[model samples]
Target: MIVAIAHSRAQLGISAPAVRIETHLTNGLPAFNLVGLPETAVRESKERVRSAILSSGFEFPSRRITVNLAPGDLPKEGTRYDLAIALGILAASGQIPHAPLGDFEAVAELALTGELRGVRGVMPAARACQQASRSLIVAPDNVLEATRVRGVQVLPAATLSALCGHLKQTQRLAWAAPAPPYAHSNLAGQPDLAEVRGQYFAKRALEIAAAGGHNILLYGPPGTGKTMLATRLAHLLAPLDDEQAYEVAAIHSIAGLHRAPGQWLVPPFRAPHHTSSAPALVGGGSTPRPGEASLAHHGILFLDELPEFGRRVLDVLREPLEIGRVTIARAAGTVDFPARFQLVAAMNPCPCGYHGDPGASCRCTPEQVRHYHSRVSGPLLDRIDIQIEVARERNWLSSTVTAQLESSASVRARALAARARQWARQGKINHHLSVSELSLHAPLDRPTEKFLAHAFEHYRLNPRTYHRLMKLARTIADVADCPAIAQDHLSEALALRRLEVAPAWPAGMKH
Candidate 1:
C-alpha cells in the first residue's frame, strides 16, 4: 500500500476535536515532509516516529514520505500525534495492515525505545472517541483516565510492537476495566466546621452560601477566622454528581492536574495567591490553558487577602461570575472554559486590619482605609451574594467553657435538603435562578414585598444587588425548609450585605 489513514484527536480547551492522520509514500529521493499547521511539539514528532518505527523492528521505507493532518487550518499541538503518525507510516509501508486502523483512535506519545507514553487531556479524547463509537488506544499509564468514561472501550498498549501485533491478529490487547462504582466513603476529607471556634453568624452565612451555590465574601480583622470560615464552606456542600464529576475530571486532566484516588467526586477548592496575574486567575496564555477559575469549576474558589490582589486581576473574574464561563480569545481562535465556581473571598476591614474593632486603636488615617476599601470594585461586590463580617472572638482562649459546636456532617445534611428542594422546584440551585424563574419560585407575599422594597429604596440598591438579595433570601428560606420567602428571610439576607453599609472610616464604600 502506498497510502494509509489513522484517526486521532486534538485538545482545544476541554474539548477533543477529531484529526485525521494521512500518510503517503512515493518513489522519489529519500526525504520526509509534514504539513497541516503543526506546532513545535507536533513537528518534532517526525523524528520520534522514525526512531520508534526502527526500534520496533519494523522496516523504514526509503522512499519519499509525506504526512498530512487533515483540516489543515486547525492548528495542532502536543506530542499526542506521535503514535498515530508512526502507525500511519507503518501501514503505508506495508509493515502493518491498514484495515484495522479504521475501528480505533490512537492518542499517545512515542518514546525512542518504541514504548508508549501517556499524554495530557486524554480524558477528553476518551469521551470524544466514545461518542464517535470508536475504541481508544492509549498507554498503560493512561488506561485509568480513559476508562473513566463509561462504555468507552480502552485498549492499553505498552509498546508499538505490541499494538502492531494486535492489529495483525497475532496478539490481542486486553480491554481496560471500567473504574469501580463511586461510594460515599470515597469523598475527599475536609476540615470539619466544628474545628472553627466562635462566629456563629459567619457559620450561618456559610451554610446559606453552600445551600444555594452563592458567592460569599467574609471581611473582618486579621485574626478573626475569615479564612477558616471560607475553607469549611466546601465541606457543607454536597458531592458532585456523575456528570459533574466527569466534567471536573476532564478539566483537571486538561490542566495537567492529577487527582488522587477517591478524590474525583470531591468539589475542587482552589486558593490562588494574591500575587497571581489576571491570566493566571482567569485562564489565558498564548496557548490558552485553563486558569484558576476554570480549575474551580463545580467547586469553591477561595481568594484570601482579596484586596491585596490587583484591581484589574479581580475584575477579570466579573464576566465568569455572571455567565458561568470564561471566553479567552487569542490570535488563533477563541476558547471557552467552564468557570461556574462558587466564589469565597476573605479580606480585612481596612489597611490596619482593625477598622471597627473596639479593642484596637486606629493606627491609620481615614484616607488609607478608604483607599484600601476602594481597591475592590463596586460591580464585583454586587455580584457577591453574601458579605458578612467575622468579628473577633473575645476572651477566646481565656474561657474554657467547652460546648460542642455544629459539625460539618449535620450542616451538610441541612444543606443537601435545601439543595434538593431547589432542584425539585427549579431544576437548579437558587443562585443560578433567572429573574423570571425567581418570580415563580421565590414569590414574596404582600408584606414581605413591601419590606424588601423599603430596604432597597433605603439602601439605594441596584437591580443586580436587588436580584441577588432575592436569591439569598430564597436560599435562607430553603434552609429553614419554608415554602415561601418570609419577611425575616429578607431581613437576614439584607443584613448579610455588610459591604453595602457605609462606615465612617471607609467612606464611599457601598455595593
Candidate 2:
C-alpha cells in the first residue's frame, strides 16, 4: 500500500477554503473512486485526470485507487482539484517523491492531452495561499492573475509533464514577479457636469452625495438627464486606494470580469435593469454568487427607472443599505459579500413620465399616478440620504454658455476636499458616522438645533431620517469649509430634501 497527500483550495463564495487530497493505492481490483461531497464538475474530473496521466507518459497504477478529499462535508465544486489529484496519484504510485510537493499548493484543470488549463476564480485562492506563506503553482494562463500578489512565490506550469519534471528536479520553473500598478485614467475625460446644460441645484446635490458617500434618488420627466447625472457621479467620486483596489479587483476576478489587475483603480459602476429578479440584484443560488450590488462594492449601484422594478426586487436592497455587507444563506452555509456601494436610483414622477410637466399635458388619472409612485415603498426612500426632483431644462439646447459651466474635475475637487476634511476629523465619511459619533463630531448650535426640531416636527421625520438630515447638514458644512453647522447650512440641507411628501394626484386625493 502507498499513500500520498497534497493540498489546494475550494471556491466558497468570495472565500478560499483549504482542501486536502489523500490518495491511497492497495492490492485489489483496478477501480478508482473519489469521495468527499464533490460536485458534478469535480466528479467528472476522474476521466480527465486518468487520461492526462497516461498522455503525460506517467504509469497508471492498476491496483484499487481510492482518493478522499478531507473534511468530507465541505462540498467541493469546480475542476480546481484536478492538478492536485494527478500529482497525488503520481506520488502514491512511486513515480515522484512526496518531499518536493510539500511547499506548494497547486490548482489547475487538466486537458485530456495532459495540458494544464486556467480556471476561473483563482485570485482568492492565490491570496489565501500567499497569506498562508505557501508557494502557488498555477497554469501558464493563470500566471498573469497570480502575479497580482506580492511576497508570494508564484510558478507557472504548462503541463503535467513539466510539473512532474520540476518536482523531480529534472527541470526548473520561473518565478513570477508582481505586475506594476496601473495609473488612474484622466478625470477630465469623464462626463463633465457642463454637458447637462442646466439643473444647477441638482448638481449641488450630487456634489454633496459624493462628498459624504450618501445614497441619492432622482425623479424627473423623460430626457431630463437623470441617467447622465448618475454616470458623471461615478467620475466625481475618489479613486480606490491600494487596499480597496485589491478588494474590488478580487471580487471582479471571482465574478470573471478578468480586468487587468492594475487598471481597476477607478470605482466600479453596475446598472442592473428593472426586470432583474431579487437573486440577480441581491445574490442567490445553490452556490450564492455575488449579484450586481456586491459587484459594485466600494463604488456605485445605479438603478434607473426605479418605479418600474418589482416592489419585492426594490425592497431587497434595504439590508445592504443599512449594513455594509450582505449575508446569503444556503443549505451548505452562509456567505457574506461586501456591498458598501452608493445607490443612485432614478424614476419618472408617474407612469406617463410627465405628470407634473410644465410643457406637456398630463393624461393619466390620479389613481394611476399614485399606483405608479407606490411601486417604491416609503421605507426604502427613507434609506436614501438625498432626494432631488430633476426639472426639465427648457433651454437644454438653446443655452450657449456651457463652456462656463463647472467641469467634473472642479466638482470632484470640491467633493474630495470635503471628504478629506471628514476623514481627517472623524476617520470616516460623514454618511458612515454613527449616532454617537455624529454627536461628537457634528454638534449643532442652539439656534441650529431649534431649526432642525421645527423641521422634524413639520415633516413628521422618523428618528433615522432626522439623523440623516443632520448628517447631510454636516456634509454640506464640510463642503463649504465651515467649522460649525450654521443655520444657513441646516436650511440648505432642509431645502435639498425634495421628497417630503409624494405629489398629490390631479384628482382630489384620499389618504
Candidate 3:
C-alpha cells in the first residue's frame, strides 16, 4: 500500500503556503526516487532519511520507494524535509501506522541515530499547519520557535522512537505552549547609549530614527563611533509584540539562527559585511531562502563602510527598501519575502577616509574623493531619512568628558510613547505616510512651505526625497513630544537632507 503524509516547506517567507509531501511505494527496481523540483539539499535528504531509518531499528523495505513533494512544479530546498520523508517511508513500509500521522503536519531533520534534529523555518511551517487547521509536530529543538504560533498544537519529538511511540498510542507527547517572559532582559554585551560621549546631535538623530523606523546614514571620518552608535540603537526600539516576535523568530529559525530555547523579543540587528553578494543580501537561489534583509524584517540592517559595497549589490536594495518586500523568481516559481527593514549605513567621507575631518587631513585628491562619493548612487541616498556628518571629538583619544547620558531604558520609554502617538494619529509610522496624508499630518507652516517649494525646484529633489523630508519632519515632531508638526521640526528635517549636497553630476546619472 502507498503511504502519503502531509508536510510543508517554506519558500521565500514564513507566511507562505506549504508544499505537500506525498510518499508512494511501487513494485519496480527497488530504487528510491524523489519527484517535484527538489534542490540539492532536498535530494541529499534521501540518504539521511535512509540512514536514519536503519539506525532507528526500522527495516528498509526492498521495494521501489518514490517520494514526491507536491505541488510538483514548486521548487523544494533545505534539510527541513528529512524527517517528513523518513516518516512517509516508515508508513509506506507498514512500520508505522498512518492513522495518527494524517491529522498533523510533521517537519524535522534526522540524524543517523534517528534523533530528530531541528530544521530551519519550523515556526512558519507550524503556522501554516495551524492555519490549515492541522496539528504541528516538529523537532524538540524547534519547539520554542513553533510554540510562538498561538492556537496551534505543537508536538515536539526528540527522536524517531518518540514520534513512533506517540503515533502508535504508546505514549503522548506534551503540547507546546506560549513561552512566558516574552520580553528579553538579558542583552549580552549589547552596547549602551550612555557609553557614547558627546555628539548629542548624532544621538538625537539616532533617537528619531528609532522612533519613526527611518533609515539613517552616518557619514564622517573614521573613529567617530558611527558603528558604535548604530549597534546600540536596537536597544532603544520597543520590544517586539508577540505576533511580531513570532514573525522574527520564524525568519531566524528558517535562516538557522534561532538555536536557543527562549524568546527573541528584542529587535534584530544584522550587520552584513561590505562584500556580501546581492543574493546573500537580498535572498536568491534555485530554492529560495530568506536573505539578510528578510531576516532583519521589523529590525535594523546596518551596512558599515557603505561606499565600499559593490555598486550593483548596493543598488539591489532599492526595491525592497521602497516596497517592504522582496520577490525572487526562478523557473520553478516566484516567492516573496517580507523585508521591512530599517537601513542604518555608515561610511567615511572619501576613500582616504578623512575628507571632512578637522582633526585629520584628507589624503585623497578631488577626483578620488568625487569618485568615492559617486560609488553611492544619488537614488539610494535619497531613501535615507537622517543624514548627518560626525566630526571626530577634539581630544583625539585622551579626553574623557563625563556627563550623564540618558539610559536606553529611558530613551526607549520616550520612543515607545512617541511611536504610540504616531500610530494613534496616523495609523502607521511617519516613514509610511502617503503624500495626501502628509499634507494633513505634517502640514507645513507658511515659511516652511515656501522653503520646501523653493528647495524642491532649486535642489531638483525627486518626489521620494520630498516625501522623505516630510517624514523626517514628522519624526522630529514625534521626538519633541509635540502633537503637531512645527517649524523647528521642519528645519531639523531639512538639516539632515543637506547630506545630499555633493559634487553635481549630469542629469539621469545614478550609481
Best by lDDT: 1
- Segments in model 3 whose C-alpha atoms lie over 4 Å from true places: 1-12, 16-34, 37-46, 63-67, 171-178, 184-189, 259-263, 395-401, 451-464, 500-511
TM-score: which candidate is best? 1
How many residue pairs clash per model?
0, 0, 1
User: Candidate 1, residues 1-511: lDDT per residue as tens digits?
Assistant: 2889999998888899999999999998998888885457655787799899999999889999998988787757758988999999999999999998999999999998999999888999999999999999999999889988888999999999999999999999888989887655232356888878778889999999999999999988888888888888878878888898988989888887876548877899999999999999998877678999999999999999999999999999998998989999988789899999999999988878888887897687788887888889988887888988888877655446236778898988999999999999999999999999999999998999899888878877766787888899999999999999999999899888876743432554575
Weakest 10 consecutive residues of candidate 2 by summed lDDT: 502-511
lDDT of 1: 0.88
Clashes (candidate 2): 0
What lDDT does the true structure give each of the candidates?
0.88, 0.84, 0.79
Q: Candidate 2's C-alpha lDDT?
A: 0.84
Model 3 clash number: 1
Question: Which ranking of candidates, highest lDDT first?
Answer: 1, 2, 3
> What's the alpha carbon RMSD for model 1?
1.9
Pairs with steric clashes in candidate 3: 121-254
Please identify which of the two predictions, 1 or 3, would achieve the higher lDDT against the true structure: 1
Q: Which scores higher on TM-score, 1 or 2?
A: 1
